[model samples]
Every structure is written in structure tokens, then in C-alpha cells.
Target: MTNHRTGAAEQIAMRGLLGTLNDELGSPLAPEWERAFWAVPRHAFLPETVWLGDDLTTYARGTAPQTWLSTVYADAPLVTQINDGKDPGDGERWPSSSASAPSIVFRMLDLLRVHAGHRVLEIGTGTGWNAGLLAHRLGAENVTTIEVDPSLAIHAALALKHAGLEPRVISGDGAAGFPAGVPYDRIIATCSVRQVPRAWLEQTAPAGVILTPWETPWLCYGLLRLTVDGTGVASGWFSPHASFMLMRNQRTDLRIYRDVVRDEHVPAQSVTLLSPWAVTGDDWAAQFAVGLQTRTVWHTWHDNPGVDGVASRLWLAATDATSWAAVDWDGRTDERFTVWEYGPRRLWAEVEAAYAWWRQVGSPGPDRFGLTVAPHGQHTPWLDSPDQPVPSTG
Candidate 1:
């Protein structure tokens, strides 16, 4: 898969993509990165077959050349592999690796602030396009990327080679940052993480930056950038715009009926003015604020419970499956809804309190939040400043 712009058509496509990226980023790419962008075409790094959109529809370059080329230039993520590269059979399909959206790719690259001589360690080299771009800008010797899946790593390495770039692609777990590449000036994780790995902090140089997408059990959003001191601690603030898959090692595989609720359990019923939709609603800010506090709970919506007078129910359960709550919405009213609580801990009350706190504080967005990872790997999430720590459930 040699990389080249065939003729006028390919050059036109490249120009269109550049314009789209510039508009999305709200600024033109730095001259250096702009050169790298043209030097390494994104289509060269993608597989012959790529999945597009949420349904994972297949698009093959060999067959649908025009459609595939157009889709490649779109400002959207293309799923490269699903179910960790295994045939899901009849099971549900989930994205394991992808070529991240161009907008997000450039956004993160801009945030990195990589200089000419900076050594970078990138975790999760899914498609190798990012590594190729970085190598083209900062030289191949200054960048190293790791991928957990061997096949993906091999494919990415081959892709990088075809694109005339080499960045020392390593096949290993990203949680354990590569020891040989110690004191990296910039450490970035393409996948989101629940907890910052201790190795990442130890491997970074003094005043280096570690940028990774952040995830909590309650909500998976936000990009956290922490600046590491020469000491073991690192602290930074969160920014908007991220929805990457969780790191393979940090996934929680708990089902609502299979793992949480029991048939014999009798839940205590009550009433509350707080609506379930208010906390777990479409508002990402509210969900993000609640998630920072209720770190262990996940949710499910039961649209048709089959119970008469019960139009819908929102189920909330702790990650350990020890505590659970359900909020029932009748067809009539929004002022008060029925709440059910059944475990040692009251999950609904915690959510209500978390929501109240967020509202009391003017409902800050992701950017206003920050985290401090201590020397011993203790993460304390704060709002605005370190002294004002947000309430935690766990």
C-alpha cells in the first residue's frame, strides 16, 4: 500500500479535507503540521476495508473507490476493527480500534504542543496514521507508539512503513508504559482510562505532559492533560471533546439483569421530586458532574417494563452489583416520581445530592474540572482549585 496522491482528484480531496479540518479546529494547522498532513495521506494508513458510522457498515476501497475515498476524508471516525478483531458471530458488535476523527486527531495533536526535539510515547496506535503524522513532524526516532493487540500493531507497522515513516511500533499493554523509553517529554493515550497508570507518571520527564481521554463508570467523556513535576505527582485540568473507547484493561463487564437484580428482592418504594432524566439525561455536563461523585454506578433505561401504570423506569446499579435503585416515571406527572431503593447503599439519594451540588455550583462544564494524581496514585478530582475538592462516593 504505497502512499501517493494519484493526480488532480486526489489532490482535490486532500485540499477539501484540509479546509474541513481548518473549519472544525477554528484555526489553521501550524505550518509544520500542515506539511506533515500533506506528506502522509490518511487513506494510506487505513485498511482496504473500513467500518463507518455507528452501525459498523463496511466500505471497501477495492470495490467502492469513490465512496471509500470520500468517506476517508470525512471528519468522522472509521472503525478499523471490532470485538478485538474477532468475529462476533451473533453477539453484539463493539469497536475495539479505530482511525479517530480528523478533527479530534488534530485537536489532540495541537494540545500536545510537541516541539522539534521532544520524545513522545503514544499509547494505542490503532491505525498508525497518528504515529506517521507525528514521525513526519518530529522525526521517526523521537516517537514511539504501543498497541495492545499484536495483529493491530503489525498492521499499523506495515501501514507506517508504506507511508515512509517508522516510529518504533511496540506490541504490548499500554497501561504499563514502556520502560526503555523513559523520561518522555510527552505521553499521550489514544484510549480513555478510569485511572492514570502509575507507570505513565514515573516514565515522564520533569514538567512533561500526559494527555489521555478520561472515563468514569457513570460517564465516559473529557480529555485530561496532566503536567508531571520532577516529583511523582502530576496535576491538570479537563477539556471538552472526547469519546474514545475505554482502555482494554479498565473495562467493567456487568449486566443489569444478569449481574445486578435478583427476583426475590423486595425494593423499598418512595417518592422524589428529582426526575431520573435530570441526572442521566441528554445533558453531558450534568452527567459528567454526577459521574465524578458517583464513581461506581452505571445506568439502564427500561422503556416498557410491562407493569401497568409504570410508563418507564431508569435503573441504577453499583459496579460491584451490591447496590441498586430504580426510578419509575408514571404517564401523568413530572413534579414527583416513584423511587425504589434496595441495597446497603442508597444510590438514588447519592445521585440527587450530586445533582444538587452541581446546580449549586452553577453547573460547571468539563473544562472547569481538574484532577491531581498523588505520588501513590490517589486521584483527587477538584473544581477550579485543589483546595475545593468535589465530593466522592467511593
Candidate 2:
């Protein structure tokens, strides 16, 4: 009787928490989605151990029940698996899988605009909560979820079963998609991808929507929703706020090394009146513009006083580690800053041209930008229509 009462209390608490989350999200969830949220408990899908806080401190449910319950219901994402289930000597580890934040999940679902009888294919079924929710609304038979990690797939399958739902859980690469479940009315990926795969476009039904987190080397993440046409092309606009962990195969590692530069080499030195902060700071619109124009380059910033009273420096490096540029900002009242570039590619020049193009085009935001994926997996970022492709900085 005591256990029954505890379960009942938890259900009530979960309902209340869901209500709060719904309100915070501006009540965007459909009535069916809300019902599904109440029916499918997120706590059941979470693992026994999770990482908490920025430091990735390990938290076990058995050791701290209150913290576990609180975190399980929180709107924030919970890191369930790290370093592909391997231990790091330090607590800090790369998060390979996570239960996405509830609000973002709902937002993605809303963008998907699925219907009651719609056949849905979900990629990256991290913890099965999303699958459970989809199953609750569209019936388990209408939902097919795929996870790359076999362990995660098994655990998600078990969790869905425990929740009294049975969505088809497949263990395979999400990029390839599931041809068995081809012609899905809607497809969604919980993970982020550098480029939408050709298989996704080929497998989706005509007029069906594909939603996923999209990223470029210049910008970490954005939400993309593309609608497939009969011509084997998909086009869509991006939302700035969405972010997610990169899909395993799409991850890139770039670091700085001195050997890439030669002592005999000399780079052209120049100064620009543009402030680095103006381009790299909170202005995501500019960043997106730069990202689409400049390929395979990322930027980092630092603050400190140099011998010439330079207060800040912005560094850019290529993913191949073959090119690098540094822009220095001194304490001078003037807007001009010093730039140094190495390697065959002049990265800073490309950035400046990109930023200039963005300004010339009226400084559009993510919504103003769109993506076009060709049948062969080539991606073309556009300003407004698919006809006007954004040119890359050469």
C-alpha cells in the first residue's frame, strides 16, 4: 500500500511539473501531446546514473532520491551517457547521448506538425521518452525509432515497454535512416547533423517534413525543418535557438599547432575597422551569415593586455588545421584592429567579406535564411528563395 501511494504521489507530481513546463513553453503543446506527456513519464526513461551541473558531476538515483526526482522532472536536459559509456578519470566527459530538454522536444514536435494517423520515424531515440510520447499520441504502430548505439536502443526499448508502450526500436545508423519505414509522414532527429543525408531525403514521403538540429563549422547549432518535394530536394528555414549534441559520425576535432606554420613564411598584414565582438558576440545572425559563407572554419576569443596594450584577440582556425588567423584589438579609441593570417587560405579576409555581405543584404536572421539539399547531398544555403543561393567567401 505504501509503494502504491508513493507511485500515485509521483504521478501527481509529474503531472504538475508537466503543466509548469507547458506554461513556460507558452502552451505550444497540442492537446494530444499534453495527454501523451501525462501518460508517458520521463523519469522511467532516465538511467540510474546521470551527469549534473556544468562540471558533469555524476548523480546516482539510489544515493540521492530527491535530487534524482527533481532533476528528472526539470525542464533541462539530463546527460545520460558520456564518453560512449566509458569512464573519464576526471568527471568531465563528452556527452554522447542525452534526454533532450522537454521544451525543445515539444518545440520540435510542434514544428513537425504530425497528425494522429501520421507515420513517424524518429532518429536518435536517446532515452525513449520521445518515442513514448509519440506512441501515446499516434499509437505505437505508427512510430518507428532508431538509435545508433545498440545499448541505448535496448535500454530505450525496455523503457518504452515499461511505460506500457511499444514503439519499434531499431539499432542502426540514423544517417542511413530506415528504408523499411520509408515514406514516413514526418521524420525528426534528436541529434544534430552537419548535413542532411541523401537517404533522409530519398526516404521521406513527398510533402513530408524533416526536422533536425543543423550545424556548420562556423556556427555550432540551429534548428532546421525541411519539406521534401517530388524532385528529391528538401528546403527549409532555420531557427536560431535550437541546439543539440552532434551526431557521432558528424563530429569534428580541430586544434592549434605550431608546425602548421613555417618560419620562412610571411603573411599579409592588414587592419579593419570592424570590431570582432560585433561579429562574434551575441549577433547570431551575423555568425550564421559568416558560417554559410566561410566553410570549415571556427573562431575563439581571448582577453588580456599585450605589450602594445592590445586588449583582446579573436582567433580563427580551419577544421583541417591547415589555416589560421588572428585579429587583435588594442586599447586605441579607433575602430581598426590588426589581423594576421597564415597558410594558403586567408581566413580573416573571408570572414570580413562574409560579414560585409551580411550587412549589404540587410543583416538577416536565421528565419530569413534557408537550406537546400540536392539529391546527391550537396547543401546550399540561401538568403530567401532556393534560387538565390548564398555565395561562399572564396
Candidate 3:
């Protein structure tokens, strides 16, 4: 499709999406915000295809105009990069860039409570769309975003420049907050973080807000809104459900499990006990449970021997190698898992406990939870209520 046609279609979609979002949010989204949404061409920042399959082979690409349009405004994420580090040639499953869905973006913005003049620091500069929107509201000079990947950082910077908006775009580790522009009025992270980084709290101004998706043991993601006290202490509630890629360094290490789990050790019992398909498709419940109990460590893969059907292998391990669980799947048959450990607690049992906790809470939505942060080395609880202190399980 021609650029004009694509832009026209995007405009229509944006108007409709904004209207729907406004109705759902029970308030009119700010006009300037709406204008920013309308003005940015989302597809310009996306790649030709996005992998939507369990494996890297399958994808949803922009082969046709309709296909591109459908993928662009479908209220779903479109991947822009895979395992080429910062390049796009490698046919891997890693996702480096994405046009985050409109609803999720709006949810984060709503949590941010960004006003006309709030100075904001965004953690992930994926497509530059988010930074553009913030720049529209707070003025270009007041927004600063940090991206870890140098190639992605350059692309995003060019994209923003093309859109005629300028924000202090830096290529650096977002985990280390942007210090040159310290004490921001608001800090919003577009990436998912296993732990709230200490730099964020330290850099936020007094009474400022820090909004990001907090990793949890539930099936859904939590949008945490924290209020900084200017003393490296912040507390607030988890306001919504959203997800993002884990911080670059915090990504799960799959080396050991990938090497250990082969065809010979495929357990027959876990075959039916766990669904391979369901497990691969973003099982936040299982992922978060394993993350909390094992300190953000896990590995999973499918077991396919010769011409026989497919089974799955799940290895839950800790950083210290103190605990591990090997669950196998043979089609749909049950396979008894061998839980091995010499740790303070059984990893699999903790996963089961977290799952049970979810059921006991009536499977509460992610929006109901919250996060509170104190400076690094300072212990504080992320409570469900302002008064109720959540005991540290770590």
C-alpha cells in the first residue's frame, strides 16, 4: 500500500481506538494525547513481519496492505526484531522491537497520570511511539528515554527525529536510571522488570510517580504506580494488566536446561500433566510462580525424538543450583517429575504454593495488586493494601 493510504487507515483506526479507550476509561483522553496518537505513523517503526507462532518459523508479516493494517491496529503486539542482536536477519524467537497495543499503552499512561508539564523518563525506547506521546504532552525537552540496544537506540532516535519530536534519547542500560536528567517528575518503564531497580526511586522527585509493569506470581501482569518521597522510598498500587520483555540482563538463562533436556530423559508422566502448547503461550501463572520461587530462573523446550509425536520438557532451576524440577510431556500422558534439591526450600512446591495462593485470592486480576519500593539494600514490602505489609518471600 502507498504511504498515504497506510497513514489514512492508521488515522481511522487511531480515532476509533481512542474513542473506545475513552469510553472504557470513563473519561475523555486529553486532546493533545489523542493528537499525538493520530500523528505518529506506527508502521514506520515496525518490521515487515512479526513472529506470532510457538517457533520462529511461523509469522504474521506485512505481505499485503490488509495484512499490515490488520496487524497494526489489532489491539495486539507486533514484533519488530528477533535474535539478530540489533539486526533483523536472524530467524530466531527473540523480540527486539514492537508496536505495543494501543490499550496497553493507554493503560500505562493512565497509571503515569502525566500532566501538561511533568518531566518523564521512559525506560524502554522500543518504537519511539511512546516517547513521542509523552513528548507531545510534556514538551520534547522534558522527556528522556534510555534503550539498552545500540542499534535499536539509533533506529528509535531516527524515528523520533523523522516525526519532528526531540527527546533526550540515550543508548544505555535502563536499569541504571538516566542521571543527567535526574529527579524526573515521573518515571515510566516500557519494559518488564523482575525487580524494581533502585535507580528509578533515587531519581524520582518528591511526590513524583513511577509506573511500570511489576512481575508477579499471578497469570496476569501488574501496572505498579509508586509515589516517590524524594528519599529513595516509594509506595503505591498495581493499577492494571500489561506485559513487556524482561530487562536485557534479567532474561531467563536457558543454557543448562537446553543442554540437559534431551530425548532420552523425557518423562512419561508429565507428558499429560503439562500441556506443551499452553506452556509455550505465555503462561504467566507458571512463569511468575517459577520466577518468585526460583529467583527468576527456568528453561523449557519440546522433546521430539525421530518421527514420534512431540512432548515437552520443563526444567525449573535456581541460580545457585540448589533446587531443580524436571517435568516431561509425552503427548498428553502423565509423567512423574523428579524434583531434585539441596536448598532452603523445594522449588516446585513453592510454585504450587503460589498457584494455590492465586486460587485462594479468587484469582484476582493483576490490577488489584500493588508495588512499594525502597532504595537498594532497604527492605520494604509491596502490599496489597497501604496498611497490610507483604512479607518478603525472597
State, as a TM-score between 0 and 1, how close model 1 is to the true structure: 0.97
Window of ten residues with lowest summed lDDT in model 2: 1-10
The digit string of per-residue lDDT tens for model 1 on 147-224 reads: 999999998999898777889999999999999988799999999999999999999999999999999888989999
Position 242, candidate 1: lDDT:
74
| TM-score of model number 3 | 0.78
Please identify which of the two predictions, 1 or 3, would achieve the higher TM-score against the true structure: 1
Which segments of candidate 3 are over 4 A away from where they belong? Answer: 1-7, 19-28, 47-63, 84-91, 216-220, 256-314, 327-344, 356-364, 377-383, 391-394
- The lDDT per prediction is 0.91, 0.84, 0.64
Best of the candidates, lDDT: 1
Among the numbered candidates, top TM-score falls to 1
Q: CA shift at 69, candidate 2, in angstroms?
A: 1.6
Name every residue pair that clashes in candidate 2: none
lDDT of 2 at 238: 89
- Flag regions of model 1 displaced more than 4 Å: 1-6
TM-score of each: 0.97, 0.91, 0.78
Ranking by lDDT: 1, 2, 3
